[model samples]
Target: MSNQEENINLPLVHKGKVRNVYDFNGNYLIVASDRISAFDWVIPTLIPNKGKVLHKLSMFWFDFVKDIVPNHIITGNFEEFPAELKKYEYLRDRSMIVKKANRVDIECIIRGYLAGSGWKEYQKSKTVCGIKLPDGLQESSKLPQPIFTPSSKEENGKHDENISFEETVKRTGKDTAEKLQELSISLYKKVADYALTKGIILADTKLEFGFYDGHLILIDEIFTPDSSRFWEVEKYAQGVSQDSLDKQYVRDYLEKIKWDKSSPAPELPKDIVEKTLEKYTDAYEKLTGRKF
Candidate 1:
């Protein structure tokens, strides 16, 4: 992303990994940037048009699932944008005005397959976040059924720690915990089933919930490549890591180079950036059935 955003007139409320959120009167303006992060470090280089790709894909999924759950989006229309963003032509499709809500502090993650932290924990204990699985599960192996794994919401630099289901009930009330877990799994199943028709496997994804108007609402990005592990369906196999179309593409490259994953990450090569864009674009197109 460019430094041009400094000239925009808005009260920046939160600067996340790839999205810069600003307060919009009673709402919020989330601007998706081309910034790519690997190992929790936002890289020095960017994939072209990545911001719009992610933002557009998120918009698509939000509409597709709005019937299943309430979301925070107001509209992506420029006409509905506040006067502050009216003069900023660059904030067109990459930005959205959303109603702000009292955010739930728990990270609601649902896993349909063994990968990432779930895989690591399963490798040692045959369980994921205290949820036991059948024996003989391998890396990239699909779980017998989807499972809810809750985690604590951490600061930008800190890793999110997984907590057991019982512990989640302790943190959030038992009712809220049950609601989150049930909603998360249902949402995951719906999206995962849709992705299968598109020839993409929705391995797992995280959802953030917030209480709005005394009800739970889904917030933040949903099922985008940035927030989910998407593997090409044709290449998926048990006992082997599958080729992916999400940020895992960049993670794999970073792992290969052994960059130590600390702050001030090494610059990405031009080819890497191009490949990353290809994956992100492909995911958007496949999921939404629209040209990226």
Candidate 2:
């Protein structure tokens, strides 16, 4: 459903691909459902506990990275939630009550490797998002240094176009743009290094930020299976796709299908869904050092 249509019943604020956000007076309640998407489209089946898993993962990261950057989470107290959602107490870990703010209109992306859309751009013009890369870089190859790649935060169903840092400055003002880039790179480096010690490689990730009284705070989800590419450190090899604990199974299944990616998405088989769930669980366990 379109975001506006989905907002009609509840005090819905924003509905993204996998989560439904609701506004209750001054506080906001973000609900993570069982929704699963492939190739930017929501598939029919649901992954059990997928919402809770993502919520817990983000909560864990927010705590881990809080020392480096502040977040917008207010509370996840189930007992204090409004009576309207009393039945969903089980989802306490899957949702959060946060102080909503004016979220910036740019997606702060940090890339430490050449892959995905970045790889495609490099193939065409030896650049990704208007930033030129060095010569002789292979697919999935690590760059000499991580770079901050910013993009316009398009609405749901629209594409997010990558733009240069100067363009980002034009849109978000010079100071805000500079601050987002600095914080993005810092958070990515710290988290990536921590993940390395745990045997997982954070290939690249995107972060969403919002402003509360002129202070930039990390909002939305952070470093989950959906937001970041998590690969096995031992399988790290340049010039090829690495085995991942993220959405590799889903992408592989989609590749096997004969359906054109442009058209409506094809349905995934049960085995594919089950395997994807396992990967998500594995990633959570590895990152948090706790069983999902």
Candidate 3:
């Protein structure tokens, strides 16, 4: 079924690049779509089964980290869904029912490697998010330790701007800011260590948090290819962009074509879409030890 047309009779709360959120009894139903985005633009083509891979991987990670932090998930199992939602069989493996929380407007980014915007920033100032790093670091070099770099989370069609730690403190106040840093680092360390055991490098990940009844809880997707950079340990290299099992492949393809960012995004070739789905599926299987 085409996710774009599968209207669930629920009140639409948000329609993001790759997910649609619905209001359900004071809660939210987040449906991961087959849609993919790169270079901040939503690609015209959809990757088959991409949404299921993301949903399942997120379920795995949420369960894995429940001991470390409370999350907004109420349930992801379709059979357990409220009776009213049962007719939408399409949501079975691609949707999650979660508590409604006041979303924190900051992107809680934890970088354990020199890559992406962090690498670009480091090349110029030897610092990422204003956190000075040791000199001589390469493109994909691992940092001495993970650092909490926060960003202002913008709405769809906008870019998230990285901010300093002090800026985070000013925005969130001292206590909430410190708590976000502590939880973000702890979550990264635990998951990165686990990913290494499965022969994948959890390069860096972006996290989101929200306030639930006056308490901070993890919200949004965690550790999925769309939210994290996953590289095969076998292909690890320094000073160069490592082959990644994530949407970085899509980003690379877009870069190679030299598509100017201002124009409407172009449709991806068949091969590109298939290969992109493969990378996401591979990450899901490798990390979850289950067939995608």
Candidate 4:
């Protein structure tokens, strides 16, 4: 269901491209919708079971990394949710009760491999987010080391532009900026390593952090196909774009059709929607070792 169609009784707080946030008492109820977006547009079609895949994968990763950083999740367990929430059986496995936080307005991006906007930046200035890289890096070449590149977090329907670390310090305080970098890189390395063991390469991922109760904690989604680039290890090639277990498949289709970004987004074909859900479920199964 689309965010606009969600029928939760709580006061609507924010409706993102693929999720709806509702004010639940003083906390928040975050529901993952089946809506899929590409090129900053929320596609009109819904992918079946897409929301459950994102929510379940996030629940697994949140538990896996809780030792490194606390998250906004209060409980993913439906049984533990408030009695009022239990009435919405459709929310099962697709929603979470979370702490409301003062979210930091930076997209904490860690790139282990050169691709996407980072590659476009490297082709011209040999830098990403103003971080210089080694000479002669190909389109999808593995970087010598992962780097923390941050961007300004824009509101929904706007594009997020890459920013320099200095700009990050300017926007946030120096101490907060440094801590964000440290935590972002650490989290990326740990999860990337774990993904490698599962035969998937976590090319790059954007993380969101927020201040909750005077402590910085992870917020939003983590390592899910929507938030991260996942490539099959066996299919990876340096000089070309690798097949991804993410929405990149849908993005490629949109690009192939040459959909003018200014126009109303096109509805995805049935095969495309099915394949997209397959990719998301594939990532979830491979990373978490659970059938989807």
Q: Please list the C-alpha lDDT of all candidates, in the order they appear.
A: 0.89, 0.84, 0.92, 0.92
| Model 1 residue pairs with clashes | none
The global Cα lDDT (0 to 1) of model 2 is 0.84
Give a tens-digit lDDT track for model 2, residues 141-190.
98888889998988858777888999999999999999999999999999
Residue range with the least summed lDDT across 10 consecutive positions in model 4: 1-10
The residue-by-residue lDDT of candidate 1 on 1-292, one tens digit each, is 3766787778899998899999877899989988988777889897778889888998998998888899999998777776768898778888888989889989999999999888888989988999989999899988889999999988958987899989899988999999999999989999999999999999999899999999999998888889899999888898888789988888889889888876579888999899989999999999888997
Whole-structure CA lDDT of model 1: 0.89
- Tens-place lDDT per residue, model 4, 162-218, is 899999999999999999999999999999999999999999999999999899999
List pairs with backbone clashes in candidate 3.
Answer: none
Error of 1 at 101 (Å): 0.5
Error of 3 at 183 (Å): 0.5
| Winner by lDDT between candidate 3 and candidate 2 | 3
lDDT of 3 by residue, 122-159 (tens): 99999998999999999999999999989998896788
Each model's TM-score?
0.96, 0.93, 0.97, 0.97
Residue 80's lDDT in candidate 1:
79
